[model samples]
Target: MFASSLAVVLLTLAALLGAIVAFAWAWRKGHFHVDARAATLPFDDHDQRVARPWETPSQARERVQAHGPPLPPGPGEWGGA
Candidate 1:
């Protein structure tokens, strides 16, 4: 009798765990994300094919010359720029 009672408890626990796992699996696989698209997107199917921003000549020059002719550091901070 004790053995049968233990088995019942074990089976009930197993069923509960199985149901929880099944629900999680279905939620992950199904269209549960549809309603949350607005909040979830702008990242989910993120724009992979975005066009590169046009860089003006001055912007390019600023980026390229920001380092400027390797000016040496002053005082105790040597090792060229």
Candidate 2:
């Protein structure tokens, strides 16, 4: 049982490595060149471009309107509209 289980684990690891190599071979043949800027864009200064959190006064108005009218006080009466 020990030897069989070890063989199974080794086979699974070999298959996983083979899959990664196959992927890399295809990518290299296609000349995939991902630039450093593309990788860094998500962490760049997005705060500077947006200027404001929601961008405009209309957006703030929409957010304020989202918090319903008022809620009734009770276990069953929880409707905020």
Top TM-score: which candidate number?
A: 2
Candidate 2: lDDT of 52? Answer: 31
Per-model TM-score on C-alpha atoms: 0.33, 0.35
As a whole number from 0 to 100, the lDDT of residue 39 in candidate 2 is: 70
For residue 24, what is the lDDT in candidate 1? Answer: 92
- In candidate 1, residue 71 scores what lDDT? 31
Q: Indicate the TM-score of model 1.
A: 0.33
Q: List the candidate 2 regions with Cα displacement exceeding 4 Å.
A: 1-3, 31-48, 52-81
Clashes in model 2: which pairs?
Answer: none
Write out the backbone clash pairs for model 1: none
The best candidate in terms of lDDT: 2
Give lDDT for model 2: 0.56
Q: Write the per-residue lDDT of candidate 2 for residues 1-81, one digit (tens) a residue.
A: 567988989998999899899989988887566665677555423322222343377764553455433222343322364
lDDT scores of the candidates, listed in order: 0.56, 0.56
Q: What is the lDDT of residue 7 in candidate 1?
A: 95
